[model samples]
Structures are given as C-alpha cells and as structure tokens.
Target: MDKPEKGNPADVQMSDPGKKSGKQPVTACLICAAFFGALGSSFIYGYNLSVVNAPALYIKAFYNKTWTERYGQPIAAETTTLLWSITVSIFAIGGLLGALCVPIIIKVLGRKGTLLLNNIFAIIAALLLSLGETAKSFEMLIIGRLIIGVDSGIALSALPMYLGEITPRHIRGSIGQFNSILICLGVFTGQVLGLPELLGQESRWIHLFSFLAVPAVLQLCVLPFLPESPRYLLMERRDEAAAEKAFQRFLGKKDVSQELEEVHAEARAQDNLQAASVLQLLKSPAVRWQLITIIVVMACYQLCGLNAIWYYTNGILSEAGFASNIIPYITLSTGAIETLAAIISGLVIERIGRKPLLIFGFAAMAFFFSLLTVFLNIQDTVSWMPYLSYVCILAVIASFCSGPGGIPFVLTGELFEQSYRPAAFMIAGTVNWLSNFAVGLLFPFIQVS
Candidate 1:
C-alpha cells in the first residue's frame, strides 16, 4: 500500500487534540438524509420484526386457506408449524446472504448508491407480499420475507457505517443511536397499524406487508439528493475535491479544511494495509480485539433473549391472566418503553460513555429477569405479583433499548477505521442474523420443551 498523497492541503495535521475545530450546526440536509435513509432501511427492519407478530394468526389462517385450496384438504398442524417456521426463519437466512454481500456491494456502488439500490429489495418484497393472498400462495409470503431480510441485513450494516462517516465524531454516538430509535419507532408504528381496527384484519393483512414500500419509495426519491459520505470519498476513493464539497454541504459551511485534514490523517494511517479479506481480517493481530468486541456484542444482541421476550410478551401477559384483547395495548407499551429508552440513551450516551451503559444495561436486565422469575413463580400467591411481572417486562425492554439493543451497531462502526469496517460489519451482521434465525426457529420448541 502506497502512502496517502502528503502534499495536498488535506494532509496538515492539527497540533493540539483539545483545540478542535468548533462544530457547525447540524444541517437540515444531514438530518433529512439520515432520517429517510433510516426510515427506508432500519424502520423497515423493525416493522417487519414486530409486524409479523400482530398478523401471525391472520397469516396462519391464510396459510391454511391456501394449503387447503391448493391440496384440496386442510393443512395438518405439523406441516403448518413447519411452514410457518420456515417463513419466519428464512428471513435470517436471507440476511446472512445479504451481510456476506455487503463488502462487495459497498465497494462497487459506494454508500449512498448501495442504500438507494437496497430499496429495490423492499419494493420487490412489498409487491410479493401484497399479491400473496390474491395469488393464494403462502410461498410468496415466505419468499417476500426472505427478500426483505436481505434488505434489512444490508441496512443494518450500511446505515451505521454511513451515519458514522457523515456525522462529526463528538456527536456520532448521539446520531448513530437514531438508527435504533427509528427501529423502535417503526415497531410502534407497525403495532399501531396492525391493530384490529386498522390493517391487521383477515382481509387487510396483505396491506401490512405492502406498507413498507411507502418509506422505501420516499427514500429512493430523497436519498439521491443527499451527498455521499465525505470520509468514504476522501479515504476510499481518494477524491479530495469531492470530499471537501461534501463536508461543506454537510456542515453548511465553506471552511471544511480542518475536517478534511483529519480525514486525510486517518486515510494515511491505513495506507500501509490492503483492504482485508474475511480470512485475513480474522487472522490479523492488529484488529483482533475490535473483531472480538463486535462478535461478542452481536452475540449479546440476539442471545440475550430480547427478541424472544418480544415474541412471547403477549403470551406471557395472557398466561398471567390478562385479557386477550388488551394484549395489543400492552404490546404497544413495550414499544413505547423501548422508544423512550432509546431517546434517553441518545441524549446521554456521549456523556456516560458506551461501556458503562452496556455494563449497566446488561446488569439491569439480569436483575429484571430475576425479579420476573420471582414474580412469575409467586403470581398465584400474591395479588400484585402479576403487575410486578409486567413491570419487570417493561424494565427489561428499557434496559435493553438503553444499551445492548443499540450500542452494538454503533460499536461496529466506531471500532474500525475505513480499511476494516466493511469486512468487520459483514462478520458482525452474519452473527446477528444467524442468532436471530436461531431464536425464530427454536424458541417455540424451547418453550414447549
């Protein structure tokens, strides 16, 4: 690897770390870009995640209807279980494929271009799902889910990388958390939309799947107008002039010399190394801890049983003797708690630092889980025990969204420089989706067993 060109104006390193250039106000354009990009990508991911929960019964009914119409007989329970499991778990399989594709796709298309192209997956998924019932094909729903899973996998990797590169470092954690916040918002929106009076009806369930296209279309229209990442242009593509213009546009100011210099120094730091292949990345001593941190964080992300809790919270509520009709309202509260936690986390993350939040949040989750166990075990003995179980559930959601739920994505971007980030994300994303797949496929069986 050759040294970064040193004679350019971008090469002048600043002398004092504390004497940082004052940050310009975050511009409307930057917010719009991040917002729409997240809406099309992360929001769709959250929507798909919880939206399926609301319509599970309706969709299972449709599946039975389709199987009977096609085979001239009602579907057996065993086969129905298998088909539903496949439909849910295949999304993670597609996500794994998408994560594997990230390095090549981003390298070829650039960050903004890849996000624009990712919307194609969302659109195609919406179309397939919208038409699945009209065509009477449960297979179409399964295939559509697989496609959107790919879309989510790409977004999970791309959006954080894109957000980190574009935003100023001092505020990166705050803004990066917007990815998780939007995900909570998407889940809330999906839950509200999937209510009985809304789109979760037997005849209207297809529309719930189709609604994801609205944001995808909005992103497609608006994203092209936003600038590509300045760091990506300067560090990866070596386009100094273009990177300068992008920085100016992002900051809404002409004087981007200091920022450009910082970017140049980072690029020069990586000049000795080639872009790492997956095998080489795993073997490299220099990035060993960074890679381990990412893998561990992702493992915690799924294996913490947060998704499993979300999948069964309503069932838990019902078993605790809550009415079936109020489950949607209670589920809505979970999303609200998560959204509030994400908002508070965003506000304080920079001040508290990432490690403390991760430690505290995980610790809090364990405590809550313990309390939940006690409450669950004693619910029949105490009148207030069920309410305590409910509080424990909310506390778990709050603890999670405050740290473990969102920080891993932020960490994945922060741990690596430009050189190793894409590959690192690929590995982390594969871990994440595979873990999600495991939960989706096995949780019901685990509960039964």
Candidate 2:
C-alpha cells in the first residue's frame, strides 16, 4: 500500500499545519454553530420540498374554485391529483439543472459562494410563487417551484460536502446528521408557520412562498462570515497551510491533525487517480462503478419511501382518518420525533459505526413499509389502525433519516477522488432529486393503488 504524504492523511498533499498554542476542546457553542449552519442548509432543502405539500390544501382549493367557475365542470380527483402532482414534482425538474450546475458553480464561485449565490433563485422563486398564487396562475406556481427546485438541488449537492469537510472525523457523523436534522427542521418550521388557519386559507397560499424567503435571506446575509471548505481550499487551490489554519480556526478545539490528514490524504490520493473525461466516467470500470454506486445509493434512499412518507403528510393523515383540522398538529408531532431522533443520531454517528446504522435503519424502514401496505390493504377499519400506520410511518421516517438519509450524504463526500468529487457528488444529487420528482409525481397514484 502506498504511504500517505505528511500534512495529508493520505489522499491530498496540499494541507498546511500552522502551529497551535494548544487544541481547545470542541465547545458546545462551536458545535451548535456548526450544527446549526449545516442544519439551516439541510432545512432549506427539506422545507423547500416538503412545505409545499401542506399548501396543496390551498392550491387545490384555488383550482377547484377556478375550474368550477370557468368550465362549469367539476375536476375529477384523478385530474386534480395529476396536475397537483406535476406542480409538486416541478421542483425536481429544476433540481436536475441545479445538480448539473454544481461543478461549474463550485469551480467558479467556490463552495460557499456557490451556496450563497442560490439566494437569487430562492428569492426570485419565492416572489414568483406569491404573485402566481395571488393571480391564480398555476403556471406561476410551477415557475416558482422550478426555481425552488434549483435551489434545493444546489443545497443537496453542496451542503453535505460543506459540512462533511468542515467537521472533525470523530464527530463527523453527528455533524453530518445535522444535515438531516435541519432538513426536518425546515419541514417542521414550514408546517408550524403554514398550519395556522390564517396561513392555510385559500387566500394565503402565497404565504408559503414568502416563508422560503426568510432562509434565503438569512443564508445570504450571514454567509459572508463563514469559512470555505478546507477540502476545496486545499485540493482546488493547492494551499495546504491556509487549509490547516482554516481547520484550526473554524473547527476550534477538535484535534484536526488526524482528521485533517485523512481529508488531505483522501484528496491528494484521488488527485492521482486516472482523470477520466466525461465519457470515461460512464465507460471506465473504476470510475463507472463509483458513479453507479453514487446514483444507485441515492435512488435507493428515496425509493425506500421515506421522503414521500413525510411530504404527503396531509394525504397520509386523510388516509389515516384524522380530522382535517388536526392533521398539521399531529404532523408536527412526527416532526418533533424526527428532530429528537436526529439529535440522538448526531451523537451516535461517532460512537456507533456508519454501516451498522445504515443496515438497522433500512431494515426498520422495510418493516414499516410492509406494515403500512398491509394495514392500508386490509382496510382493517379498526379505530387505531390508521394511527398505527401513521406512527409506524413516522418511525420509518425517523430511522431512515437517522441512518440512510444522513449516511449516503457523508459517504458521497468521502467516496470520490479529488478531481471528480464535485462531479461525482453532483451526479448523486441529480439522481436523488430525479428520484424525488418521480416519488412526488407517483404519490397520489400510489395512495389509491
């Protein structure tokens, strides 16, 4: 085996070590700040996607009122469902574009700048969504969703890589888990703000669009102070000393040397791998296999029915036979559960191994999916049956997020050789968002099927 170069764990040779007075212990404040920043990024992703589903109640209200008056005809549930699903999945379509843009964004803007640049898309889309809803144009909502989708894709591709790089190895899992936790936070916050009768009314669907602006502005405003990922600094710019100083400065108390060496080693080693052109990423055995792994992992993670599980909460609530008025409150309960699970998962990411958590989470989800299928199929009609499905589904959601949803993200950051990291990560994101679109589009059909 080839030995790692000094200043590099083994992969990249460009890391610099600035002498430190002493490594401070990782403080709660620092951890919270890192976790919160990462959490905010992931929340942007989850909120942009899941929050829209709640507004379907209002969107459907608008469509029903409009088509009924204009056409003197009632829209079929199937037709309504199809159109709504399209509107929901439109973001996924935008994501494909955003994910594809990751390499150029990272290369030109650097990771932090690329992430901050997404504020334009978020604000513009949010404004459009509000105007469209007020004007009663489905087209405007579609446009807004498409723009939000692009922002979502950008976050999905870059945020995990950002958090993964800045985090200490010993606590990478927990910090990485912050990604999922924040995503859930987004979903939860959206529900809380949107669930009030005033917010959810047909007159206020535009409010949902406005909700997104808060984060977009927050990210843009504070981003000037945040550090760029050391991996990007070291690998792309070949500035090792600056990278080490950054690690010490930002991470502040984590023994960054071992972790720093690993990151440097990983980057440098992959830098030496056969650089494949676009064609070779698809054709070369090693490159192709890695690309395929990234794609398949992303696909499998979504198809496991976790995201659809949350995004369709209102639909799921109706199926579970809950009163319409009370669903969001209950949905918030699940959100709380998810947040607690994420906090625990973050702590365990280091103490427990990644693969074990992945396997356990997957197995638990498969079990819950099976349960949901059976209870829904039997039409069991028991008073508690739908509640059982709801709770089980929440459990599966928690487990999937705690493990697979969170794990694949960190794995993607760590998997690729330096040159292709951006490309490889982007491809995985493309696959994930594409899968998300498919799931959102198919959900209504799946509900009745």
Candidate 3:
C-alpha cells in the first residue's frame, strides 16, 4: 500500500485513547462485538472464580464437621486441614506449569490461537468432572481443576493482554475495566447456580463444573471470527499492508496510510530489541522493574484472597457460620455488590488515576483481611458476627473490582513498549495466575490457621 500524502484525515492525532484504538464503529453492530469481546473470556476467568466453594461442602460432609476429606477418603482433623490446603493449592500447582507455558503458547500460537486452544482444555475438564459421577473419584475432580488452572493461568495473563491489545485505546480503560467485570461475571455465574436454593433441591454439584463448559464453548466458537490483534498481524508477522488495512478497518476509516507507516516504523525500532530471553527480561533494569511491578501488583491482587471467596463462596459462608442452604444467596449478593462497585469505579478512574487507586486499594485490602481474622475468631460466640464477616468480604471484593483488579493489567499493557508488551504481559500474568492459585489453593489452610 502506498503511503498517503502526510496530511491524511486518518493521519490526524487522537485526543481520546478510545478514539485512537477504534471508536467509529459504535453503531449497534460494534456494540454487540464489544459484548462478544467481554463474553469471550468471562468463563476463562469465571470458572476459577466459582468452582471452589461448592465442593468444599461435600468434602466437609464426607469427613464430618470436625474433619475434611482427602483423596476421596475421610482424614483426621490435622490432616483434614492439610487436605483442604492441597485441594485449593493444587490449582496454583497446576498454574506453575501453565505459567511456564504461557510465553510458549502466546509466542508460538499467536494471541488468538492460544486462547482458542485454551478453551479446548476447559471442555475436557468439564467432561472429566462429569465423569466423576460414575467413578466416585475425587482425583478426577482435582485433576480436572488442575487442567482448568492450566487454562485459567494462561487466560488470566493472556486474556487481558489480548483484550488490552485489541480494544480501542480510548475505551481501553473501560474495556480493561471489563477484565474484572468478566471475572466477576464468572463469580456471579458460579455463585448463582451454586446457590443452595437452586442446588439444594437436588444433588447437583456436578452442574457447577459442567455448566463451566458453556462459556468456553461460546469463546471457542466466537474467537475465530473476531479480528486478530492488529499489532500481532503487523508487528510480529510483518504484514505491512494487512496491518494498515486492519488499522483502518478498526478505526472505521479508509486512508490510514500514514498510520500504517507509523505502525511499521514503531514496531521496527522496537523489533530489534525483541531479544527477549528470561535473562534479558531479568537483567534489563527497565524490563526487570516492569516485570517486578507487574508480579507484585498481581500477587497482591490475589493475596487479598478474593478467589478464596470466589472459588469457595459457599465454603466461605459456611465457615462464617452461614447455613449451607443460604451460602449461594450470600455469594450472589457479593456478585451484585461487586457489579455496583465496578460501575462506580468506571466513573472514578479518570479522577483517581491508576497509581493512587492501586496503592489505596492494596492498603484497604490488607485492612479487610485483618478484619477477617477478627471475624473468624468471633464466629465462635456471636452469630451476627458471621453476617458482618460476609459484608466485609464483599467490601473487600468491591475494593478489588474498583481498583487493583483493573490496574495491574492496564498498566502492564501500557508500561512495556509494544514490541515487548506480549511477552512482558505473558510473564506478569503468569505470576498473577500462580499467585491466584497459591492464595486460592492454600486458602483452606490459610483460613484454618
């Protein structure tokens, strides 16, 4: 494609980041596409968000109130605690493998293909869980979750990278904001169905795991249709004409020749530095600081133990002394509160800025977890205390939704130069997922102690 004379209309500078990325296609059609973008990864994040709570109840039932099950058998009280720890932490353990594989998947598969393949893992996991009914094998259930963790770990890092990279820059903040929205969507999906009012009527715990497959299937189908990341097409693959064409198509303009050249020029300068190795990432001060910041921010996001509540929502309610029958309702309420808080967050982001929101978010989170310790101790004496604990738990989730949950990936996508964004985010996100696995998988032990 020939470069347009320097003064092309599409060559003009964009004031809003959203406009820069792709805003002109804002009719009813593009809006639906945006929703599909949101829908794409909801389950990828949501499956992990909701899987933990319901199973813990059955595990508890197996070993009595004073104990918990291990490897499908009842265990002593001390071992019950260890058993639960293993069950939860296994998600993290599985994540270690997935995390290691992230760069490979994204690098080899390109952004879109890796995610589509990741969903295939989700389907197999659901099938394995459904098969658990016939075999009565707890191992299959844990292994199934481990596979999901592999997929989830990859998605947690890659989904936002994919979303952040592909969305209109102007709306990046809001769409990036949707990262948690979809995560909470998953939490909501799992919590709603897991509600004892619904599941209590029948033995349907399998329904929770089985239902997780639906979103994966949806993403699996839709992913092939959506445009692949323009950056990937142009930068990595060097399809100059196609990249410019994609950029123009995305912006809803035709004369993007200068923008096309800019894309090549930018990727060209950075492309030489694609000398990314684990050592290069570790040794370069700029890259290293970015990696550290990404990992720390992501780790802190999970350390609040949000997934503990999300994955094990029912278990959390039960521990606080909510009746097993009522836990799902409480979990759903958490989802509602999270949704409201996110809306308010979308409003406040422009005023608050990212760093301030993140710092305050983490500080508030540390305080809330401390409050959890106090509430758990009080659960022995005051029945009302459990309800307060539930309220506090939701408040913490709100803080996460409004703040840290969104910022880490957004900053990550921004901080690294375009050349390194994919690889850098891949590493940072792997850390995030592994940490989520740690906090979630070991949450039973963390809480018991």
lDDT of each: 0.85, 0.73, 0.67
Residue 96 C-alpha lDDT in model 3: 65
Please, what are the lDDT tens digits per residue for candidate 3 over residues 1-449? 22321221222343444444444553332333345545655455665666656566565444343223334444667765666666667767666666677777777787777778888877888888767655656667678878877777777666666666565555556667766677667767666776665653237777777776887778767767666667778777777676666555555667767556655666655655673766556656655666777778877877767777776676667778888666666677888877777667756775678788888777887788789879988888986999778778977888778788677867777666665565676677667766776776566665666
Question: Highest lDDT among the candidates is held by which one?
Answer: 1
lDDT of 2 by residue, 1-449 (tens): 43322212432332332223223356554354455455436777778756776777778777777778778998788778887888888888998889888878878787777778877888888889888756757778888889988887888788777776776555556677777788878877777766766476666767877877887777676666767777778777777776777677666644567646666666655766643344545554555555666677789888887777677888887877788888878888877777777777877876777778888988898888888888776556677777777878788878886778677887777665556567777778878888988898898787777
How well is each residue in 10-117 modelled by candidate 1, as lDDT tens digits?
Answer: 223533323453345778878887798899989998888788878888888899998888889999987877787788788888888889999999998889989999
Q: Give the least accurate 10-residue stretch of model 1, judged by summed lDDT.
A: 2-11
Q: How accurate is candidate 1 locally (lDDT)?
A: 0.85
TM-score between model 1 and native = 0.94
In model 1, how many backbone clashes occur?
0
1 versus 3: better lDDT goes to: 1
RMSD from true fold, candidate 1: 3.4
The per-residue C-alpha lDDT of model 3 at residue 207 equals 70
The TM-scores, one per candidate, come to 0.94, 0.87, 0.85
lDDT of 2: 0.73
The reply for model 2, stretches above 4 Å from the true place, is: 1-24, 27-40, 66-78, 239-244, 253-278, 287-292, 379-381
Clash number by candidate, in order? 0, 15, 11
